[model samples]
Every structure is written in C-alpha cells, then in structure tokens.
Target: MAVGRNGRFSGLLVVAGLLAGSWTGFGQEKKSEKVVVAGTPAAAPVPAAPADSVTDGSVTVGGQVIAYRAVAGTLTVGATATQDATIGFDGKTLPDAQVNSPDKDKPEDAPATARIFYTAYFKKDAAAEHRPVTFLYNGGPGSATMWLHMGSFGPKRVAIPDAEHQEGAPYAIVSNESSLLDVTDLVFIDAPGTGFSRIYGKDKEKAFWGTDQDAHAFERFIRRFLSKYDRWNSPKYLFGESYGTPRSAVLSADLQNVDLNGIILLSQILSFDNSVDGPKWNPGVDQAYALALPTYAATAFYHHKLPTQPAALEPFLAEVEQWALGEYMTALLQGSELPEAKRQEIATKLHGYTGLPVAYLLRANLRVAGGVFSKQLQTDEDTTTGRLDSRFKGPDLDPLSGDAEYDPQSQAISSAYTAAINDYMRKQLKYGEQQTYLPGAYSDPSFSWDLRHQAPGGPSATEQEGGTNVMPDLADTMKANPRMKVMLAGGYYDLATPYFEGKFEMHHLQIPQKLQSNISYHYYEAGHMVYVNEAVLKQFHADVAAFIKSTESGK
Candidate 1:
C-alpha cells in the first residue's frame, strides 16, 4: 500500500483491486500517479498534521502511558561487524523498550539535551555462533513498524479478529503463527512520528518524516541499536513491506556503503516510478491483467463464470507476453495511425488475453483502467461483484458507479493479514498497551485525491530529475555492489505491481546478465502483498527461505 493507505478498511485485500485504491490505495481514478517511493506518492501526499508541542506526553510502550521527554537526536550508520557466531540476538520481538522502563524514572520535564532510546527483542539461547539478524519494517511513510514486528516476524504478535468483515469486531489483532523469529532475530523500528517513536519538539520537526530524513534518522537508529546491543558482527539482513521496501533498499545501499551485509526486499519497489506508476506512467496494468488473466479465468472458472481452462497462470502469461509486446504495445504505439479494423482486432485480442469484454474494451477507447477491469469482468448476474484482487470477484458491485469494484480487500488480502498484526502487537506482544495500530496513517480514506494527468514526458522530470526514481538507482546499486542479490516478488493479480510490469521494469533495468542473475523474480496468485494469501504465502515463505539462505551462505 502506498505510504499510509492502510488507514481505510480493506474490503478484499487478498486480491489486487479488491481494495478501493491503487499504488498507495488512492483508488481508481488516480492510476496515473507516479509512485516515486514504493506506494508513497511524491506529488500527492497525505499532508502532515501540524506538529504538536513536544511536551511530556507518553504513549503505551511496556504498558502504561507514562511521561515523555524530548531531546536532540543523532543517527549514524555503522560499519559491518566481523565476529564469532556466539553472540545470538534473540529471535524474540523485543519487549516494549519504550522510554518509561521500570529501571529509570520517565523524564517528567522534556529533557534539556538530545537523547535516543532503543527497544530490543532478546532470546537467551547460547547458539549465537552465526545468525541472520533481520531488521523489519512495514510500509507507510507514517506507519509504525509494528505491522511486521507483530505480524509474520516478531517472536510475538497481536491478536486480530478472525474475520475483519465480521461486524463490530473488537479491534482484534493477535500473535502470528508465521513469524520470521524461527530463523531471524528481529528488530522493528518506528519511523519518527508514528508509534512510540517521537522526535524533539521545538525546532525539532526535522527527524520525523520523508525519504532523505528517514533514511538519515534510521541510519542513526541502526548505529544506536547495534551499539546498544553490542552484536555488531552478526550477519545482517533487512525485510520490509510496501514503503519499507524503499527504506530497506536505500538502507541496503546506505549500510553497505558503511559496510553492512545483505538486504531482503519484500514486495520490492525497485524504483518509485516503476512502483507508483499508474496508467500513464505504467501500462503494467494490462500486463497485470494478463498475468491475472488465468487467475481471473480460474477464479471465474472456480466460480463457474468463464471456461474452466486447464491452462495455468504461467502459460497464459507466456502467451500474453507474446501478444502484449507484439500486439498490445504495437497497438498502443500506433495511436491514430492504426486502422479501425486493427483497433477492433486489438480490442478482441485484449478481451481474450485479459478476460475483459471486447465491447468494454472498445468503448473504453481501447484502454481499460484497473477499476473497469475490477467491475467489468464479473458474470452478468445483477449480483456481479468487482474484485480488488481484480483476479477475484465479490458478491455485488455498485454497477451504476464508475469506481473501484471490491476495494483492495476482497482484492487486497494483505490488508487483513497486515492489519491483524496491529492487533497482534497489542494482544499477543503484550506491549504497546497505550499505542494504537495506525494502519495507514498519512492516508485519508474519505479524502478525495484527484487522478493525475499525463505530464507530457516519458517520466516526470524533477529538478535533478531525481525525485521518484528508484529503479535506476537499483540498477546502479547492483553495479556498485556486485555481490548483492535481489528478488522481485509479484502477484499475478497485483495491479499495484503487475507481474508483467515488474518484469518490464526489470527488462529496462540498466544491468548486465551476470548482475541480472544476482536478481530473481517470483510470482503468486495473490496481489501486491501476496504474502497474505495462505497458499501463496506458504510457497513464498519456502521460496524466500531458500533465497535468503542462498544469499547468506551456501546451505
């Protein structure tokens, strides 16, 4: 989800378009957005609330909301440590390390000087010889890192509702059965303004948010965290979701520059443009539709709408690649010069390739937005439900309206999985009693974000043409760090990071074949956060375990 889009209720998040928004859940009309930083929109941002006075306010950490103290902060990146495998950072999610620990008095008056606080999860086991210590964080420029901390990673988690759809479910969140703690000693960091993490008040708005500042502050946090724990020599790894991908990626480079170890990119955003591009910036949706085609057909087949094809998603996408690149791209490039018959032919081909109706394709002027795909592909029953997964359908869609069909839930499976983590932190982790899970802060579910228009250039050109470009840097980073390994995980149904677009983005990456092998790609039947899909996640975990193992050391 882009930045803070998690704030809204996810309808069908397992599926891509099942949820209401795109990129960062801005929803349909805004498909033209340029995702410069994971799902975070560079141009359209969720305005930050005016900074409150940095008083002695406290939020739940270990338990009660005690007093808080403001201080000047310093963050620095440290060099990679070389050591014996005996120093095991516990695989446990650090218990609330908030400022008000029982050991010291909670600073009543804001501190006069700058101070930094660190929280850690510890495991008492002695087999510390060599371990993969992973630092985990979730997306959302404004989100607390708790999603991953409590969800699939932290040794402990939140207790979430069984079904998010169940009416009036107490903000149920719970301990996750699938935490990375089994293999990794995990650490979760809260960005400046969210969660229990706070910044200096006065002229102290500096450490709280945005890309550069965050990377800088987080670098400091890593330094503090490593020094505080004294495990500077452990083999380190980073795992992040949504915006955290960028955070992880940039930090991968940052840490490596300072001699850090490898990085694990979960739901990668190689470049902001590649990640956030809507229709204009990205036509990956069509390819996404293609990758999603068989799944759509299969889901329909399972739902008994389309032909029960024996073919699977891969072969279907293989055919789609041949056509999309040959016919679709050709058609798009033809513009007005293309003849009427060719347009109809392209539309017909697109319908078959995409499971969209030929008439809808033609009527859409040969272009169908992700929203249209969500709403149109349903069976003609007045009971037609559009899918957020876009690959999956729902019970009913407001046919009369021209917006997202199922929302990202029925579409976005991850929303539920990730949301559950929030509850997990409170209930299971037995921590953050005072803090609430800020799902997708920085997002306004009710606020209307205008869909952007074509900027008339290949990609938006910023001052240095540097804003929102991560893929190029990814390419450059790979060049700089020859041993680094990269993996791109995409869901066939993901409209956010369509399977084909991801492939296409990689196709255009400025890297060589040897370096390319350093990068790998995988696909699932789910959407962006395919990790939420039970079946897909099982496989994804297995695959990820293998990938991480290979990168860390030969098994």
Candidate 2:
C-alpha cells in the first residue's frame, strides 16, 4: 500500500487502517474532548495520575513457562529540551518550571509535548546486562503498535483465521506459544496520538507528525525508556513492521550515541519510490513494477489463477524474479519506443504469471498498479484479492471500479485485533481503563504528516524534491556499526510491500559490499502480517529467537 502525503495508506495502513465506523467501539466520551488550540486560554491542568500500571503475567512458549512483569505507561517527551524539561517522568511539572505567568496562561506559550504510551515485558529474574531487549511496533506512520502487540510476538495473541475473514466477536484471545519472550524482553509502543499516547501544547501536530519528527520522537522515547528501566547496558534491538521499517532505518541512524545490536524489519519498504501502490504517479521509476512481479506470480499461484501452476512455489518465483528484472524491466523502460511485437510478447508472459487477461495487460501497458492488479486478479469471481495478503478475498465493493476501494485483508482481520488489544490492556495488563485506545490517528481531521526527510549526512535537496527514501540512513548506520546485524522478513503473498522489494532495497544499500553479509533475509508463505498464519508464526518465532541469541552472545 502507498503511504500517501498524509503518511497514511491510500488503500490500507502500511500496517492496516482501522475502519472508520469502528471508532465508536472505543468510547464516545473521548470524541467530545477537544484539542487545546493555540491563542486560546489554556484549560485547567489535569490532575496528575500514576505514571504507569504494573501487572504480572506468564506465558508458555515452546513448552517452557516464562514469567514476566508488564508495565503499561506513558512517557512524556517534548519537541525540544526546554519543553521536555518542563515535565518530570512522574507527570508533574518540575519545580524550576512551575510558575504563574500571564503569558503561560496561553496554550501556545507552552512548548509542545507528547505522552507516548508503551507496554513492556521484562522477564522475571533476568540479568539486565545479559538479557536482550527488543522494541516492537507496527507502521501506519499514523498507526499504533497494537497489531504487533496483539497479533505477533506479544505474550498473548488474538486468534483469527489463518487466511480468511474472522467471524464476529467472542474472538479467541489466547496465550501465544510463538511469543518471543523466551529470547528477548519485548516493548510494544504506541506512536504519539495513537492508543493511549497523546500530544498537546502548541502546534503539536507539526512537532511530532512528520518523517523526521517521528523518528526523533521515537529516539527520545527509547532513550527515556532505557533510563527509566535502568537497562542501558542491555543488548538492544528494534523490530518494526511495514512503515515502522522505515522508521527503524531513520531511528537506527539517529540513535548514534548507542550502538544497537540489531534491527528486525517485517514487510519493509525503505524507499517510497519502490512501492507498487502509486508508482504510476512517478514515471520512469520502473523498479517498483519489476520488484513486485514476483509477488504477483506468488499470489496467482496461490489462487490457482496462473496459466500453469508450478509444482513448487520457491523455484517458480526464482524464475519469475529473473525474468522480471531482465526481460520485463527492459520492455517497461522502452516505453513508447518498444515495438508492437515485443510489447505483445511481454503481455503474454505477464498473463501467464499474473493470470490477468492478455487484453487487460496490454491495455495497462504491462505496468499494472497494485490496486488495479488486486481488483483484476479475482474480478471473474466478483471478489477483490487482498492487498496485504492475497490469500484473503472479499466481495468487491465496486466491481466496475478501476481499482480496489478497500483492502480485503484489512477488512478481514482488523476487528479482531482492535477488540483484542482493548480487552487485554484493560482486563489483563490493567492499563487504559479511562482513556480511549486509538488504533489510528487519521480519524482526526487535524492530523497531517510531513514527508520531507533529512538523511544521515544532512538534508538532501534531491530527497526534498522526490519521494522519501531512508536507504542512506540505514546504510550509514550499518557501516558505522559493522557488527550490528539486520534481518529482513516478509511474506510471498504480500503485495503491499512485496517481499522481493525488501531484497532489492537491501541489495542496493549504499554500504560497502563486505558489510552486506551482516544482513539476512527470510520469506514466509503467508502475507504482510506473516504471523497471522499459525504454521508460519512458529517458524517466525524460531527464526527471530535464533537471530537474537546469535547476536546476544556478543562474540
């Protein structure tokens, strides 16, 4: 899915956008609360509450019972040091900053601040310096980390169909046998304005709602977390999904004071130009189409839509990947100059791999956009193939439309995740009893995102003029910390950020060739959210655990 100028998915939340109507389920009272606007009299300061709620929990992973202490809380951060120094970790204003002033009465006079929420699991009795800690989050740019919290490596997970629509409520929320608690302490964070996190003061949106600003907010949060928990010496790792992958890339570079042990990326898209969702808008960027072709073939093969079903998926995709980068890319580059015979030949090949009609392929000029492909792939059955996971299908909202209006995968499983996190946080973790847990911030009309990014060395004039790309930030981090390992994981059925696109970006990183060996790749037979499949979840858990253990030894 494309991350629009607003930093939200046009079709889905790079993670998965919540359905608009689901907002009512969170609570109606919060809807009445207003954002304190600049130039207005500041509202009476709310009474200070406990900074966090503490709970104890245990989960059985790989037949071993693990006990943990869960802390659900919010950490206040400011746009700058002056703003941050105003509030203490206890949510109380500092003594030096406490003063009655005429100008302070105005909301704009105070600096912008955000109370970033998080749920952290620390293994009981583990040595802080010896045990590894991994920070996990999902990406919408506007999305909360609830998906990773409720559906992936969390101590518990909401049980839904592996690749089908989940039936209504009474959904099973169960202990996750695949939980990563066995190998690392996990911290799942809600981005500012999502879940229990809240931003306030003057121009709060501009302060925290952009590519560069968001990474800085996370950097501050991580630094504050390490200090609060006194785990500064622990092996630290970052695990981010979808848009979070790009956030990790920038954040890894920003946190230069600390040398991170590793970064784990799922459903990655480091370069916005490589996304298939809106490549049509940027002419001459043919890499997106070529990189996405392998995923198209995988999806077609899964649905039995391909002209010839390959006996093995891995080998078939290998063949398609080779052709996509070679013959197919060459044809697309030729554009208007390509001979009719060559264009026809390419369309024929696309038909065999994508299962779309030859005429439709020809009409599209052999460069099918992600949404159009999702709509056309299963149009014969009057269904829309999923953009997040092509293994999922839902009735088309508009069969006659040029592209899919909604993602079938998002629609199929969003409710289960939303409900699971709400219930678990309140009833189990004992947090957010009075506040609304926002799955996304897009519901707020004031929510806006700045796409401009400052790379490692400095702000690039070229980046300011084009789509945001954090490949330099990641490459710089890897080169500076050569021992810092990176793992890229994705699903073959993921069209949102095609699995092959991750490989393409990693291969092209600006780092030295010798440093390339520090990166690893893993692919699943599932979709964007690979852990949605129980079978794949098992392998996902093992792979991640092994990676952490291998690096944690500090050899």
Candidate 3:
C-alpha cells in the first residue's frame, strides 16, 4: 500500500476509473457513433486484440551474461467466462459473441473489461518446464508496477539516494546486477487503469475496483498469460509488494487448479486491522500500537533519538519487542482502570524506547498512532519523519498539526522512478510510445474501493466491518497446497506496514504447526521500499534467488 500525497493511506482504499477511449490504434474508440436501432440494443464493443513489442537484451547478473527476450504487451480480460469466451488468444471473436453481449440498458449487463499491461523477460532458449516464472507487481490497489519494474528486480534500475531526497535529474538508469533473471523469469504487471492498462464498458469502477473483483482480474490475466506463452507446466510463483500481499493471498487461494510453487511477499499486511496508520479510530484493538512500537524504536535508534542510546540496533529491538508485546500490551488493555502510577511507569518506558517525551506519551494515552509518531518524533527539529521510510525526513508541512502532511520518501524518489520508466519503456522496451504512463490511479474522483470480501469456506460478499483480514485465505491456500512455500520479507523502518505486523499475522494463521515450516522470514534495515538501499537490494536478490531455487521443481 502507498501513502498518498495527503498523508492518508491509499493503495487499498484508493480505486480506479476507465481511461475512456484513450489509445488510438488499440480497441478503444475515441467516440462511439450513436446508432438508433428498432427493437435492438447496442452490442458490447469487442475488446482490442493483444498488442506486443518484442525486444532482446542482455544483462550481467551474478557475473554471468544473461541474454533475455523482453515482451512489453497488453492482454485483454473479461469480467466473466461468458465474456471471456468471446475473445481468443489470436484476438478474434468466437462464434458465441452474441451469447456473451448483454443488453446495454439491462441491469445485469457485464461489468467493465480490462486490457492489462505487462513486461515479461524470458531467458533465451530456456526450457519452459525447467524455468520458474515469477509474476511481480507493486500494490497501490491503484498503483502501477513501475516501482518494482524500475527500482527493484527488473533488468534495469533507477539510481536514487538510498535515504535522502534525490535532487532534480538527469537521473541515472543503470544495469541491475541483482536482477532476479538469473534464477527466474520475471513479469511485472500494472493493475487495470494504471500504467498502459485500461478498463472500459458498463459500471467500470464497480466492475474492477474491489477486493474480490481485482483478484479475479489478476487470476484471468495470469491464466491467459500462461496459455499464450505456453508456460502452464512452469513452476510458478507470485511476487507481490505492499497491498499486493493481500492480493496474493486471495489470488493464491482462488487459483486452486494451478499448484503454485511459492509466494514471495514484500512489506506484507495480510490483516488490515494490524495497520498502525490510524488505529485510534478502532479504539479497543491495541495490537496495531503494540506491533508498531518496534518500528518506532528502530526509527528512534536510527535517528539517534533514543534517550539512552543502544550500542546495537537488532538487540535493542529484541528487547523492545519483548516489552511491547508483554508489559506494554498488558498496560494498554487495562485502559482507564490502571492506576496512575502504572501508567506513568509505562509512559517512561515508551519514551526511553521511542525517544518521545513522557508527557507526550501520557497525553496520547500511550497509544500513539503511526502518523502522530511521524509528526512528533522529530518535532524539536521541525522535521516530519517519513511514514514509508522513517530514515527519510522533510520539513513539516504543518508544524502545529497532529499528523504528518505527506510522505517524504515518496516525494524523494518518485520523480526519478517516473522519469526512468517513461524513458525506458519508450526507448529501451519500445512500448507506450503514444500513451502516457500513470504511476497511480488516484486522480479520478469517481474511484471508490469495495472492501467486501468472501474468504474461503466463508459466507459470500461479507463486508469486513472491522477491516479486511485475509489471514484465513493464506492459511486455506497452504492447507490446500501443502507443498507450496511462502517467503515473507519486510523492512524494520517501515511504519506503513510494520515488519512486526507481518510476523504477527503469519504466526496467527490457522494452518497446522507442521505447515509453519513452509514459511520463512527475512528482515532488512531499510524501509517500505527496501530496494532503495543498494546494499539491502543485493541481499534481497540473494535471499529470493535462494528461496526460488530451493522451492522450484527439479532444482
């Protein structure tokens, strides 16, 4: 999930809208000519055929030259099987087109369709069955996969400051020595209505902009991709970051016919209730605060804000984690019934760990929210700590305000990413020459997210009144596919989805104790976008490569 310009958590909450006739040569028409027919309704527009631009490139990874074929393309997907049957891999309408197109004025008309965009890199002359293919995407629910494509595991990466705000460019786009191509083929996909992906047809927003609906779209896209590329026998894996983590859980469970080899989650948040963003709204649920404390302590330790400086970070964090889940949580649960002396004692400890004033902690009732912490952590210097990466700081937009106004980390490197993707897609990849790339889909005011979800073996269309939790989905997937492996990676400095929250959710999954062995965890010293740190990125590549090699068939 991404922190928006307004400092509100976006990614999951933000939705998207149709670009409404954007591309010229594509299936979307600029304007539909009105045709009046007697006793007949307008036929649903046929989706454009799949468009692809193939290019060959080579990158040196792990000190070996890897020649790869890159395909930048779009594949159309329907809202349902009936609509899907109308289109084929060759982009021709099937004989059953009339059966799929419903009356335009009918309430039961099909929802909007999407032409999902993706850039895939295949190892030259590799056997499909032997090569593991990993589908990678960034989560903004509304965000494009540009971050992962341009900043992380792709063949080329955008170079920016690790923890400082990058100044205006001529930003360098360099060969990624750590690209995952050495171990697995990579496909980076942009969500519908983001990047070159577009959605159109009836009730577009409601059709593709919800939890279940979005998962379904991705499911269709993956299936279609496998069929088109003849990779059904390949050992497949899903690599999702941020909001994409929950998407992976749901999608993994839904794709029961396909036995995935593994799932790699970066900066995960399977349970939204564990979010530290604005836990104050939910009052009695104190886990968010407790889960976030370790990250707060890590940030304080990094910034040298701790009252008594700890000699080492990891050991200090271990102590903080123990206190947070033990004494700190017990004190919070007491809530107004606790004696003033105990409250003072807890507040003092919080200050020592977080470097916030004891008076501030007392004023906050010891339940400081993530935004408030970001605002108050560096208040003495009039700086606002980044919610995504606390290591990055910026001048406070509102010094007197209780919450941070914007994310400094996002502002710091967004330009370099945007510039790099635009240049690279056009110049290197030879796609999107005539279209504009949308980094995210928050610009449209018509966008609205649907939080209702139907978990496996649960009632259908249940609104998550207490916030959406997909821990059950992951657990059910593991139970169904007992051999499937899972990898969890996160940054200690990420307050957006604290590293501890991922651990907490994974520990609480309803799977058997034996299945717990299928899961592995890795932590980095960086923030939400851990690859921003070159050192962490190198280690991340190694861990992921090793995980894939261990899990893939015939490895």
TM-score per candidate: 0.69, 0.92, 0.91
Write model 1 residue lDDT over 1-555, tens digit each, in one string: 333122343321111121122334434233343334576522222122222212122223223232223121122221112110112122111354333222123222221111222234544352444666666676555555544554454444444332133343344443344544445455666665455444432222322344444554566567556665565766666666666766665565555444434565555554444332234335433333333333344334333444334356577567666776676766767667879999999888765655567777787767655555555656465333333244444455465765444453433234544555545444433444454444443443322221111121234322233224355545666677777677777666555445565566677777887777776877877655565454565576666666667766522
Model 3: worst 10 consecutive residues (lDDT sum)? 19-28
Candidate 2 per-residue lDDT, tens place, 1-555, comes to 223332333333342211111111110111333476778655444335445899999999989999999999988887775556676765456788964432545655556778889999999988866689999988777788888898899999999988888679988999999999999999999998898888876778889987778888898889889989898999999999988999999999989778999999999998888888777767888889999999999999999999889999999999999999999999999989999999999999999999999999989988998888889998999998988899999898777998877777777787788889999998998887678988888777666556677887766623455677899999999988989999999999998889999999999999899999899899999999999999999999999999998898654
lDDT of 2: 0.83
Candidate 3's residue-wise lDDT over 1-555, tens digit each?
A: 343655333332221211111111101112233355697665456445446999999999989999999999988887776676677643445676776455646623555678889999999988866699999998877789999999889999999978898679899999999999999999999998888888776777777877788898899899999999899999999999988998999999988699999999999988777878757656788899999999999999999999999999999999999998999999999999989999999999999999999998999999998889999999999999987889999999889999877778777888788899999999999998668898876555445556667899787765334567788999999999999999999999998889998998999999999999999999999998889999999999999999999999723
Question: Candidate 1 or 2, higher TM-score?
Answer: 2
Colliding pairs, model 3: 1-243, 11-140
In terms of lDDT, the poorest run of 10 residues in model 2 is: 20-29
Candidate 1: regions farther than 4 A off: 1-7, 10-25, 28-122, 126-129, 156-177, 199-208, 259-261, 272-277, 280-310, 379-388, 391-397, 405-423, 443-462
Model 3, runs deviating above 4 Å: 1-50, 89-92, 96-111
- After TM-score superposition, the amount by which residue 40's alpha carbon in candidate 3 deviates from its true location, in angstroms, is 23
Off by over 4 Å in 2: 1-50, 91-93, 96-102, 460-463
C-alpha lDDT score of every prediction, in listed order: 0.48, 0.83, 0.83
